[model samples]
Every structure is written in C-alpha cells, then in structure tokens.
Target chain A: MTDRNPMKDQVAIVGLGSTGFSREGGASSLSMALAAATEAITDAGLTAADIDGIVATNEPGASGPEAIAAGLGITEATHHTKPTPVAVFSLLDAARAVFTGAADHVLVVTPVVMGPWNSRRAAADPWRRGARSGILPVPEDATMAAAYAAWASRYIHEFGATKDPFARVAINSRTNAAANPLAAVDTPLSFGAYEAARMIREPLNIYDMDLPVDGADAFVLTSAERARSLPHTPVLIHAATSGIVGKNDEDQLDGLHRTGQHVVVDQLRRTSDIWIDDIDLFYPYEGFTIITLTWFENCGFCPPGEAERFLREHWNDDAQRIEIHGRIPVNTHGGSLSEGATRGTGHLREAVHQLRGTAGARQVDGARAALVTPGGFFFNPQGAVLRTAT
Target chain B: MNGNSEETDEETDDVLIARFAGNGITRDSADHFRGRLDRRLLMARCADCGRWQHPPRPMCPACWSWNMTMDEVSGRGTIHLLMVLHQGPPATGVDYSTGHPVVTVELEEQRALRFTSTVSDDFPAEDLAIGTAVEVEWIERDGTPMPVFRKAAS
Candidate 1:
C-alpha cells in the first residue's frame, strides 16, 4: 500500500444519529433511514438543502440514495451512490466526496433490518415475508455467517482454546450495553449465562452471533475547514482503510495465520501517526465473538492465540468488560453482539460520540482518540482512526 | 457415458443447472457440477501454470490464463475445518435434531485447495475431528447426485 494519504484528517464527521436498535418487528428500513437522516441533519445544525451528496449503503432491504434523498425532501444532489453494506464503505465514499470537493456536505446512511431468514419474528410478519423469496434452498453449508463458526472450531483446535475468551467478549459487550439506553440486550451477562445459551451452531452459541435488529445510523461529514462551525466538536477522520487479500473465499482462506484483518492492521499502522498506544478507546466489531477475539490479536493487543490470556489479564472484573492497559475500553457502546447489529455503523457512531464528549454515562474520560475496526475476516474487513479536532 | 449424444448433452446441461441451482451455478463451474453427476469430484486446474483452484474460476488466478479445465481430484483429504450445525436451512435427509456436520477438507491434490460438504450419515459422529482422513462418497439428494465425505479406511 502507498504511504500517500493526503485525505488524512482532512474530513470530519460533524453530526451523528441513530434510531437505536431492536429485535421487535415494527419498522421498515426506509422509515428508520429517514428518521436517522433527519436527526443527523438536525444534529449537524444543517438543513436538508445543505446536503449535496448522499452515500447510502445497499444493506439487505435498505433503501437506495434516491429514495433516501426523496424522503428527506432534498431535490438535487451532485454525488449520490449506493455502496455495499457495512458502515465504512459508505463512510469512505462520503469522506472522499467531501475531501475532493465533489460535495461540501455528504450524508452517509446505513440502515439494517432483521430479515425473515434470520429472525422468526420477522419471518412471521407479512411485510418481511418478501425477503424469503429469493433465498436459496440449499443444504447446510459452512459459508457466509456459518464460516465463522466453522473457523472458530479451527481456532479452538489449533490453539487448544476454551470458550472463556469468546464468553468474555459477550460479557464485555453486555456490560457496556447496560449503560447505553439504545442498546437492545442490556441485561448483564455472566459466564454461566453465556455457557448455558443454546448452541445455534456448535462451538458458537446464540450469544456468539450478532443480534439481528431493525435500526439505522447516519453521519454528516464535511471538510475539516467547514466542520469548525458545526454545533458538536468535530471528530476528524485520521486514517481510514479497508483491506482484503486474494483467495478470500471463506472456506478457501489461507488459515487463521493471515486474513483481511491482518492487512487492515498493516495499512492503518503504516498510515496513522496515532498507534494503539495513543488511543483512549477501541471498538472492534463483534459481529461474531470470534471476530472480536481475532481483532484483539490481529491489532497487536496480544499475540495470536493469546486473546484468552490477554483478556484475562486486562479484564476489569468489577466492570465486566475489557479495558486494555486499564485505560482503553473496548466497545464502549456495547457492540454488534449486545448493541444490535448495525453492521459497524454503531461502532462508528459511538466512536464519534466518545471523541466529541457526547457518550453520556459511557463516555471515556477526556477521550481524544479512538481506534474503530469494523467488519469481519473474509469479505469486509475495515479500520479507521478518529480523533477530536485539534 | 451412455448419454453421449450431442443433443442429450445440451439437455443435460440445462438439467444440471436446474438441479444444483442453489450451488450458484455459472458457466465457470457448470462442468464441476457435471462431474458430480458421475460421482467425480472435479476442481479447476490451470493448463498453463498447473495451479489448482476450487469453486471453479474461469481464469487461473495464478497466471490469469483462460485456459483452465476441470480435472478429477482423488477426493482423498483431511478435514481442515468442521462445524456441526444445530440449526440450518432445510434439505432432504438432514435431521437437525441430531445435528448436521459440515466440513471443508484440505484436498491432498493441492494445499489450501478445499471443498465444503456434509459427512456421510453412517460416519461416526464422535470420530468427526479436524485432520481426520476422509474420501468422497456420493449420495442422492432431491433425486440428484450429491458428494459427501466418509472416514477413509486406515
């Protein structure tokens, strides 16, 4: 990767909004998107007319840019495109749009809905039944989400690991989630509770996977120069990148020794001046408990196969969450595991909140810099560093 | 081998696509599925570079050569990854109550070249462990041939 990152700290996320997250089946993806979009626009102290660019994510069942723009009553936009799901793809597009002057104010909206395939409550709803039409009637296979469980088995086999590390990840998110009203499952989780959870996929119980929920998270980004006048303290995008390698097919991966997570760490370390030693908070995606454990190892928080040991050493027993070096908290807004899956948008939004001193009860004291690594191993591994404007 | 007529071959292609529609059938991988009809496990191999790839790609990733062909693999390998699904998509002969085993095997033909499938019904569940030697076994699924793995004879 090239060291030429002129966009570093050039763009700032000045506004943030979320519809929270819930497993209850009541809202449509569009309605949630519009709700978050309007809230974000208001938070940014800007009217709809100020948004000249839109970057909507094509999350399953999510609305496109035109629908979102029309919903917000914005008539014209020069730069509007629908990037693939997950938060960073849309964030990168919007940030690049603002940095290059393609648009002065860009809105990145990501809405996630619990589809019929994943949730029984959704499957029973008539509106969500449409999502079941195109799903392939294939036999059981280890791909996509299943691939994580399949590989989790490999991790345990290779390292002789027990369920403690994965259970700690679950407990940590639950502990943090209790402080945030927006979180879905805020009930405190204990080792016994996690171990007792029914196995949806062996080696990975129900607690191991992210909760499928209906929610949306939106952000308003503009050039750092323009962000100074915004109502909230601007959270500057220090260095952002997505990483992948060839042969990324889930089952075809080159073992746990290397993955897209490794590539992301390599790139971020090279580009960002603020390394892990400088960050006050960490938000590694917990779409799967295994993903979070790997992030801990891949980010150099600990050596490979030592997450269980690292977590045990650094875990705050009273708080029931991980605080690296007893300072940098992991997933302070809970995570996909407990916060409901916004597919990393929640991580980005919480990072912004912490940096701006708006995280309320969960805010890190005098938080200045944060490391947010989102997405998973095979397809969508992404990382970004955010810091308060100087 | 009996249905070798050109007209029958054309019909067979359409039939194969429809039968394995859930496999994400494409021109690049159609031949690999066709091999399954004869109980043969075919993986893509580069004609120019001899590099092996799975889930069949049209061009060789190693050399970017379009000259690739589906060649039979010995189907003898060790399980590299395994997961027993307590719940999953519906399929014939799969009883979730007992749990279903899905594994990706590291083919003896090439390192890191893998294929994902279920294990045979009679395969001892307790014996299913990663690195266990296995060989392909054909079974009927929805009136079509499906390849699974069974513990290889020691």
Candidate 2:
C-alpha cells in the first residue's frame, strides 16, 4: 500500500489506433491485430524500425508478440512478451519497458475475436470451429461470465435494489454509442426496451452482458521526453495498477465489501494526485452492468447500494446518459456494452481521444483528465489515471 | 451412500481421469473427484492448521503446509449465491430451456467456504431462493456419479 510512484507521468501514450468493432465476424484475429498495430505505429509518426518493443495480449484467438512482430516486419525487438488479456496489463508492461530503457518505442496490441463458445455465428464457421477442438465442454456452472450473474443476485438480495441501476448502465452506453461510429450497436436503448430484453442469466438479461465482436486496439508508448514531439497531445500515465484478493475464485469471493476493485481504488488513490472529482471523463468497465455499479460504489463516487439513486440524480435526462455533477461524462465511447467488447481497450482508446481533444462529437469540452477502470473483480480488476501533460 | 451400483472403488488414476474428462482433474484434486464416485463431498483441509479449502490445492494456502487431507463434509449449507441460466453448455441432464438453476452454497463448517452445483429436480424452482438450507444429493449424469443439492428437511 505504498504511495511511491516514480513512473508517474514518466511514460506517455503517444499514439492510438483501432479497427473499430463488428459483430459480422469476417476477419481473423491476426489480421485485425496487424491492421490496428500498423495504424498505431503510423499514428505515432514512427515506423517498424523505430519499434524495438512489442507487448501483445494473450487474447484467446489473437496472435502472440512473435506473430505480430513478424507480420509487421519488426525484425529486431529487444522487449517482446505477451501479457494476459485486458488492456492495462499490456499498457503497464509496455510503459515499464519504455521507462526502464528496454525499448524506446513499445507497441501494445490487443485483439478480440468472437469464438465458437460465445457466438452461434462463430460456431457455425468452419475455421472458428477448430478453435474449440482442445476445449472440453463442461456441465452448467457459476464461473466466468456466469459468476457475474451469481454475484448480481447477491448484490440485489443484500441491497434490496431494483433493476433500475442495471438498466441505466445499458441505456447510457447505448445512447452514447449512437454518436460514435466505432460502436457496434448504435440503436438507442430505452428503459422499456432494456426491461423487455430476454433474460440470458437470471437477474441479468441479454443487455447486461457485453457483445462478442471482432476488433483490435493498439497503442504506442514512449518516455515523456520523446512524447513532446508527437503530433497529438501526449496523454501521460499518472498511475496504473491491477488488484486482486487471495480468495478470488468467483463463487468463493469474500462478499461484495472487499474485492479487487477496492484494492485498485486504494492503490490508485494513494499514488495519483488527481481524484475522481478532478477528472472530466470516466471509463468504468461495463462488461457487466453490475460491474459498472460496483465500480461506482468502490471508487467512492457514491455510497454502497446507492448507485441507482446516485445515477438517477446525476443522470442528464436530455442526453440520456450519466453526467456526474452535471459535467463529468462517463464512458463517452459507449464502452464494452455497446462498443463490441474490445475488452477495456475501447475504454482506453476513447479516453486517449477525449484527453487529446480528438473525439469529434463524443469529446467532453476541454477534457484534460480521465479515470479509466477496466476489467472485472476476479482476476483482472485494473485501474489507471490518464491526463494531458501538466 | 454411494450413488451408483456399478462404480467400484478400485478405479485406476487413468480411468478416473478419463471418466471426468473436463473436470480439470489433477493430482491435487483427484482425491476430491474420487470421493465423488462414492457419494462423498471431500474438501481439502490443512493437516497442520485445520484450514479448509475447495477445488483442492497442492499445499495449504494459509500456512503453506504440504500436509493436507481430503476429508468428507456434512454438505449442509445455505445458498450464498444463485444464478439461473437460461442458456449454457450442453450437459447430460441439464435442460436450459426450463432455465437451469446453479447455486454456490456457504457450508456450515466454515464461513465463506462454498461448493457450486445444480439443485435436484425434486426441489421446486420457485422455492430455490438464496439463504435456503440445502444438503448434498447424488444423481447419475452420463452414468457417472454427480453430486447435486436438495432442500434440507426443516
């Protein structure tokens, strides 16, 4: 729980690129990775020769660092490794590499592809069918995606909450998605439509889960000294951390009070000077609606079990989205719920765009700081504070 | 209290691994699965400190002690977490069309110690609520003994 942060604002995200997202599922994970990786390198005003590091994420169907490097013609990389999925793990690894002089310019590429396990369309595709060859089908269980539903029931039982807060998370993302071209489902969601959505897991309907889509997001990281010459406003990494408790197994977790989210908030608050009140944009992961609600409570935006009321109070009725304190916009990029589950990469990319004043219609005016909390409570709960160079 | 008449206690490690192909059977957890064949719900308990753990581990998490034992539990607990799945992976007896109910129960032996399984068919779905008392009940799935839960007698 030390507040020591020597890396604070030392590394900057110099470039960002994305293949957007699509449910149509025509491209392979490798192609998407290459596409986004190349675009990101070009966006950073660098070439393959300049990238001496590669940090690829271990997404199920995605390519590894070796494959990505070979595809991009990066012949020599001193620092190349595959971190586990989710955006910040790779971001942190790349930032540390650049800071420690392992590489001057590091590229982080994360690709998400619909697999046969989650999507029926992907299951029907012959090429995707092979992806499940080694996997064994198990009986019904409350793990992984199902764990969220299990915990959501506990949250409702313990708090005596209605479905309003969960519905709001979906609707808010949908409303914001309408303005972002990168979003998959841009159709504005209404409270009635959310309530009427078919229930896939009890207490959580189809709308509650993130959509499985094909996409990739990539970022370029370099020391702050090198970022000053970049074209876009350098979004500095103030503090980044991933947290987890000992008994993190989905069903065995110590109730809602203490979780990885709490650990992350504790560490981030200690390391970063900017708190939630100072941020103009919020990107709490919405992989599950309940996750979004809990992040609000854990991050101290409001008291526990009061998200429904807090959201209702601060919700901008005219915009149909959350505007905390009538100013700070949440998930301005539509988030994983509507942005096709780039698995927190969309949240990171959107935050970078907004902080750089590049987000066309979705940008918050004069947005300077962003608080991005990505991943869920179990294994990958993570948080990072990004802001323009002070 | 053995669930199946055909299953014998002499099954080899290879045979046991083949039977529960996807249960993630490892040397540390093989004993737990072996107990399942005999209608026994065995959980790992630290021999040194008596700390209990589920989904067995090679060493005790609390004290890092190598001495551990697979001991039977009373299987009596209250439903701590509940999820009704309207869709899921294909299982022998699970009919997702009717919305399969899966629950993780907090065992009476220790707080926060839990085991996850489906409820027995006899337990009415309407009565399947969190905090309800439940006990282990054995049922056959694809000829393999499977442990489920049923509402405990008041």
Candidate 3:
C-alpha cells in the first residue's frame, strides 16, 4: 500500500494487552508499563527478545522506552523514542517504525498511574503548564475544563442544545461500563443524578470529566504476513492519521471541544476504503460528555449543529440503548468516560478486542470493522480504522 | 562553618532561579502591552497585513513579519460563552470566594479574535447571558491591574 492508503492490509495489530484498569492500588507507571509490555509480547506468542523497537508515549519519569526495555530484560531494543505523548500518537509511531522497515516488531506502551494529579510531584507533567496559545492567562488546573465549559456554553446557546444529550453521554458510558470488568466506574449513573451532580465548572458537572485511574495499555504491531503466525486474529490497521488545522484561537477552541473531528474525519475518509457509516463499532475518544456529541456531528453521523437532535431521536430508544447490539454500539469498553483514562490507549485496546471477537461480555456481535478516535483538548486529534481479515 | 553556609545560600539561589526560569507564556505576549492597556485597550496589528491579534505576539500570524504595531480600540466585547469555576483553585493560588464567573468575550475589534477573562464578582449570575455586551473593568490584584468585565449600559 502507498501513503494514500499507508499501512492498509500491511500492518496488523498482532497483540494487545492492558494492565487491567484500576481506580487505585496498582503498580507504579514503570511497573505497569513493564507488566503490560510483557503481557503483550507473550500474548503475541513471542518474547521480549523479539521486540527490536519500542515507543513510549508521554509516561514520564522511569517509564520511558529504555526503562521499559530494561525492565523487560530487552537488551537489543535498537529503536526507542517518544512521540507527542498523546496515546494515539504512540500507536502511529510504532506502526510507522514497522512500515518503514526501521524495525521488525514494535511495541507501543503508555501507563497512567492515577491518583490525585500531583503536578508539583512530577515536574514533567504536560498539563502542569499554562495555555500554550496564550489566548488567556489560564492557570494550569483551569486550562482545559474552562476551555471546554466555554465551548459547551457557546454550543448550547447557538444550537439550543441542552444538558439532556450531554447527560445522556455520561449515562451511556457508565451503562456500557457496567459490563466491562476492567472499567473503573461501572455503577449505574441515573439521569437525575447526572442532572443534580455538583458542577465542576458551570455547564459541566463532575461526571462530565473522564475518570482518572491507575492503569496501562499496550499494543504490538508487525507485518500482516507475520500476524498470521501469531496466537490471535490480526486486526488490520486500515488507516491511521494525525490531523492539524490553521485557525484563530477562538475557532481553535471551538474545534477543540469538538475533538477536532472535522479535520480528523476528513483526513480518515481521504485514505480509508470505507466511510463513517460502514463501521460497525465506533469509539469516540471522550474526556467529557459534550465531546462525544461533537464527535457525532464531526464524523458525518449527522449534519453540523444537529448532533443533539440526532441523539435525542435515534440514540435514546429504550430498545436500542447504546450497547453491543444497539444502534451504533459506541465505546464498548466504556471509553475513557467510564474505562480508565489511559489517555486514548484504552479505547484503542477496546477496539482491538472487538475486532478480535474476544471482548468477552462487551463484545460487539459479528464486529468486522471499527473506527476509533483518540484525542484530548483540541490539538493533534488521531484515529485508526481497524477491520478483521476479510 | 561560615564558608559552608555561604555555599548553601548560593545553591538555594540557583534552585530558585531554575524553578522560575521554566518555560511558559512569555512577558512579551502577556505583559509587554500592559502600559498601552493602562488607559485603553490595544490589539496587535500586523504591519505587513494589518491583521489584529489578541494575546499579542512578537510577529504577525498572517504574514509572519517581525513588524507589528499596536492599535488603540474600544475594550468592548460580547460574552460569547461563560462558565463558573467552583472546584480547585488555579495555579495562581487564588481561591476565589465561592468561585466566580470566567467568560470568553468576542471582541468588537474582530469577530474571531476572542479574549478570556473573568467577570466582576459584583455582577449577579442571573443578569448575565451569552451575547451580553460587556466592557473592560480593570481589577487591581497585588498592585497589578488585570482586565475583568462588567455589563455595558444599553
């Protein structure tokens, strides 16, 4: 395949592993990385000795590639590097390494050891800094939430979208999480509870935010030919891309709340063989409720400014709740909203599980193709389209 | 003992310097234009293309030219979006009383150029809504004037 369809039918996700997600009391970031990487390599019917390349995405301190390689007793890791730190970017980096013949087999790993976000304890925390755009002198804690709130408010005012759809997304995620044994927040969140929850920032309650928990997710990528000999079914990486746009700060903020869907989906369609409607499973990377709504519109599921209405009509049917068999079974692993915030890696892992027909209780039936988007804030939104061998 | 104490003091100085010298929004972007806003607000206009920008930059975004000029303008804007922060305090270490309203104001200078600032606590939350006209009202905190907003008279 050429760059027009780079990695399509060529690179396959041979193995996937996660240090079963937890809210607390797991290993440290480095330990989690090692555990997940070991599991992934073993799951692929290989050992650490077979991995020649490693990509570590944004897990700081002793969790870089060298640390993980040493922890795994991998002495021959010739290719090691860190990407933009976003989880999806790490997967893309690993895939690129394999595609270019720079490495034979590549492992991508990110472990998020969650507790109280102690910015002071870790100086390298990317979120510990102020707004990069300098659009406002926003303090670190208030940077993203405040930005999200503004977008929600503007969206509500413009489209007459209420809190109903936003709250529904929160409820739907928890509902999906209830079946996922590895999900952190699986307790049923009622509609009333969501409406009455304490506002973290106005227009957004505490439930709107992603649950930060201690966990790690890992994936192994090799050539499609090599994947056939592995222990599991190969999930073909059809399209993987990162999207950016040139716009004013205000316009960028709007795009950010939408998870940069316009740029990301357009990029995906250009290179992929299928359109949005063809995918059986969709994983919209969500850190909040409104983000999911924006993804629906940005991914061509609905017209612009019409996601709330679309969800209100098509998504709220009691017989067709967003489950594995429901209309557009989104985020079958509960997503970052309910699944642990391994950044976007958890969603990626979940997509692989469904494509492999091994998602256990949360498996989407006859799931052949899947679309997974991984993004936070607005910046570099990334995504991948995966399909089982046809 | 005297020499050791002197050495300790120098090491502490170095730690402080390194801590504060870490990267963030530079003064040229945030503070350099404060003197201009002391009386009236100003936006940076590209000398090459004459495009205005907020959170002023050293060079033009439109033309990438180093030549930039500040143009005086009305500090008036409309509240495009608004939110109230109630949880943890900001990095500024200021715990606002019962939390306060933070707003994104679409400046009258350019429809796309917006500024994010706080609303004066004196204004009741009920009186505010998106599209409400507001003008800059400087609030002096720790002897530094920061721009906040209040409802503009009809």
Question: How do the predictions measure up, each by TM-score?
Answer: 0.97, 0.96, 0.87
For each candidate, report what fraction of the true interface contacts it reproduces. 0.88, 0.82, 0.43
Number of the candidate with higher DockQ, 1 or 3: 1
Off by over 4 Å in 1: A1-3, A132-136, B1-10
Ranking under lDDT, best-scoring first?
A: 2, 1, 3
What residue runs in model 2 are displaced by over 4 Å at the alpha carbon?
A: A1-3, A133-136, B1-11
Relative to the true structure, candidate 2 reaches a TM of 0.96
Off by over 4 Å in 3: A1-3, A60-62, A115-142, A248-259, A316-320, A323-327, B1-24, B30-42, B90-97
Q: Candidate 2, A238: how far from true, in Å? A: 0.5
- Output DockQ, candidate 1: 0.75
Best by DockQ: 1
Write model 3 residue lDDT over B8-91, tens digit each, in one string. Answer: 455644543333332133334432233323645666777788888765777777789877776766778888877777754443
Judged by DockQ cut-offs, the docking class of candidate 3 is acceptable
Better of 1 and 3 by lDDT: 1
Clashing pairs in 1: none
lDDT of 1 by residue, B1-154 (tens): 1122244466767888889888877767887888888889888898889999977877788999888887899999999998888888888888888888889999998889999999998998778999999999999998888889999999
